[model samples]
Target: MTDTDVVVIGAGLAGSTTAAILGRAGIPTALVDPHPVYPPDLRCEKLDRGQVAILQKTGLADIALAATTFDGAIRDGKAWIARFGRVIDKRPGGQYGILYDNLVNVMRSAIPPDVTNVVAKAVHIVTGDDRQQVSLSDGSTISTRLVVLANGLSVALKDQLGIERTVTSPCHSITIAFDIKPRSGRAFDFAALTYYPERASDRMAYLTLFPIGASMRANLMVYRTMDDPWLREMRHNPERALFALMPNLRRIIGDVELVGPVKIRPADLYVSQGHRQAGIALVGDAFASSCPAAGTGAGKVFTDVERLCNVHIPNWLASPGMAVNKIEQFYDDPVKREYDETSKSWAYRLRSMSIEEGISWRIQRRLRFFVGAAISAACKIGVISDGDQFVPEGWTQRLRDRT
Candidate 1:
């Protein structure tokens, strides 16, 4: 087996990201995955406002993203002015519907060629007392000083490491997506997240649409629980349920458009955690992944690259013999702290769950409406503070400045 300093399995966000950072830091590294594409396929049709902040902070703001044009929103039956608050993005109004593949292309272009992207299908990972080895299905093998697993889903290596992959939520949902070309000088709005969150379909199904290109192209996301009767109709007759959500969408899209027969993905959350054996590190979803409400996967992985590069790798370089313990300590301490905070934040804001389940869900859901109304009221009442007038650090002044 060939020996290397580090071997990363799976070329999803986490793996590709870390490989890029490490290679830039002058570490000999190899990234392996069967797929040639850098951005792996993603079922998620949208990224929330927070995700945009993380993406821009990571120095990828120059790339293009899909967007819509609306300015205000009706949240829980009340009006609210939408504003973009991400620190890196100066785009004032809202977030973007970045195509998954396009985002990958941007990130890939940023990574250097020295960090080899070996095309191979990884089947298993062996963690030894001193190091690790990734066995591939192609009968090739390589040993490394450390192995970082960034595979996107529940992994067989989790079982080998004695980790449990469990699902907590009972009501599972799936997403169906397709694309349509737009018309004229118009493009989907980039200043707001347009959605009919409370709109209903036959037996209560709903579809979410997002803009994904320069002129006019859209990606639609439809969600339904396993037992939801609307799912059957969607699979059998897709068009009827689609036009109901956006009326002008059909006329603009025409009799047919390019791309997609519609794809479906389970909307359930998966949690996996355990002791990281000495020679291994679990990055990204290999450790835990949440439902749509806690849209932290991409941001979390970006944080992983930042941490491993800035914190973890430097320590290991200072003391090569003490590598395993350094990585494991990161998992137990700072990583877990971040997870706990993020998860608690998700738990508190799940609006659709039972009262006993989400501690502050309803209030959280209604917050957008309240904030929107307050902003409108302030604008109407001529009480706009230019950062100096409102107690020096008031939220309203800060939001206006951020926007």
Candidate 2:
């Protein structure tokens, strides 16, 4: 481990993207994670407009966009997607929906080699009056001026920082996706998130069908059921539950199809009340996230990286010493804005479970609707200054009394 300008703790999209951008910007970066390859993460199926723009700006866009391509209904030309819960039907060149790992590979290749990419977990985050150091599980230390906690929701690391983040309800979520050939007269176009439009359980499950890769595929998400913990036994038992909820899925695949078993995990979305802490900044899911789990974490990570590169970097560079005040200001400003953008869509989806059950939660629903529509319109029209901070126009005010 060496002293670096930045040590990104997680080699996922956010980590890699930050490293790629920072390294290219001449800022030395180190990326840490546990051997980045994982089975394809299915639920997070989108690459957003802002992220698309960021990638394009960074010059890595074409590689990622071309590595994966889709055929079927094109929103603007790709697939229709949702952000903060409102379905975006106007994506130019459509929306991209390839497997999660596929995108990771595309991003990984873009990072400069000078930016060391290590496969290790960050075990301790030590903050001092000066530079910060991160202890790794591998018995190594990597020091940095700042650390970006882009790792998606890891309670362990958060605890290590003495950061007490709320679970905000025991709400958990998981998504499983696989490909299948179409039966005669039956095919699903790669447009719209179709399948489960309503909540089906305390699991609050929903199934979606999309044309992905070489065949027709389906993605299912079961939101926080008491019994199914993703890190536990769900992967092995996917088939058992698959047959129960979707008979068509069972029939379409039959025995010949290669079932890429279900992958489950808690799906609840959360954001820091403020920057998770100082000396460290939490970007993406470690700080802010969106749902129906719209793939906002990736977008947010890029936003964090862009802001760091464009805004934060200039300010930090001009300082003669540790810019504690600047860092703190940077952290606080985003926490407010990130949560504002992330909470509305996800909170609405969480509340959707209440609605389908006829809970008479009218006022909240109306506000959620207004906020969603207004935000969608604002984002579409480019009225919002930062695509990253689209707060669904008056979202907080409308739902002010409810939560």
Candidate 3:
């Protein structure tokens, strides 16, 4: 058996980052994953300013810089934020566009030399008060003081350990991703653009256009079921369906052509139940899933890593054993709880704002956009200093307090 202080299973964003931080702190850590090179996958392809700040705070900002194809900070570019076909604000740089696979690979590469990389699938895990054991498919066993489960939404390992997940909302949201280019053969007027849905009846939250390398990538977030005919139309004829859904988009970006296959990802909101166990901790999607439309997925992951590595794990390691009560402290952490709750709340709020058709919902939707437009105008005319005022009401303040 290999001995280590920490064994992080599933070396994706959360696992690799945890190992990196712990390794830097001179801890005996082992990272377990089957893939030496993370394969191409569809996930959050962009990182916002708030997520970047968290990565920097955790000393993982360099990994993001290395993986990103379009570095807004270095490019010194601005993005146009618009709603109802009207430009709301020209936001400054600090965001980045990156492929999910590249980001994971970069994060895996940054693990310090001392951290052991176990290139095999974890078949089973046994958690105890003093020691946890992990069984790999390659017939190896690793005994460690604690295990951090960052394997995303995979349920096999979680099931072996008796962790249950409860589905909050099934088929919560759908995200459509593809590449686009101007048919006119001319460059777009802006570096990036975010176009909000013109009407809640459209069932779409927004369509974001940003650069990933030379390609202009579009992520259209909608509140729809998997079997919806509209999704079929998008799959069969993405360009026509997209233009039909948002005709005003042509007026802003001019004529555009879809360059590649349209990829659709349907997400369900769930939270892992019975996770407060001995010798184990959950992070990122392993604990709960977030709505892509809310743009809170990366933020939640970064927060989980930051809190676990810097605060919880350090204190846990200084003690004698990884007991159930000690592990519970991280789960009951005020900061982690707040961030998780905020993400869940925002997901439901965005769903209602996009698809709810009641009179009150319509009125509130209009008012929300009106307030956003007002804030944008206020920032333009020197009445307000912070451009983030245009964010959903109370979101900026809550993030400020937490981060």
Cα deviation at 70, candidate 3, in Å, is 5.2
| Candidate 2 residue lDDT tens string, 1-403 | 6888778888777777777888888887898988767446544565544457655655578878776544334333333333223443322233466778778777888888888878888888888546788999889999888788878767787776776666554554555565544344344333534332323343434455454565555666555554645324445665555555544443323432325554444556555654544467776677755554334455556666666655675567565544457577666567436644655465555546433455454455445445644654665678753334546533332232122
Clashing pairs in 3: none
Off by over 4 Å in 3: 69-76, 387-403
How many clashes in each structure?
7, 12, 0
Q: How good is model 1 by TM-score? A: 0.73
How accurate locally, in lDDT, is each candidate? 0.54, 0.59, 0.85
Which wins on lDDT, candidate 1 or candidate 3?
Answer: 3
User: Model 2 segments beyond 4 Å from truth?
Assistant: 36-43, 48-51, 54-59, 71-93, 185-193, 196-206, 222-224, 228-258, 273-277, 292-295, 334-340, 343-345, 359-403
C-alpha TM-scores of all predictions: 0.73, 0.71, 0.93
- Expressed as tens digits, the lDDT of each residue in 1-403 for candidate 1 is 6677788887766676677667767787888888787544654445544455554544544442323222222112221222221111111233355556655555555567887677888787777766678887778887887777787684676787787777765344444666544334343333223232332232222233444443223333334466655556555665665554454444323353344555556555666666456667777677666544334556566666666665776676565543456767767557545754575355333324212224464454345445545664565566864233544324453343222
Model 3, poorest ten-residue lDDT window?
Answer: 394-403
Across 78-111, the per-residue lDDT of candidate 3 in tens digits comes to: 7777765677667554458997888887887788
Clashes of 1: 7
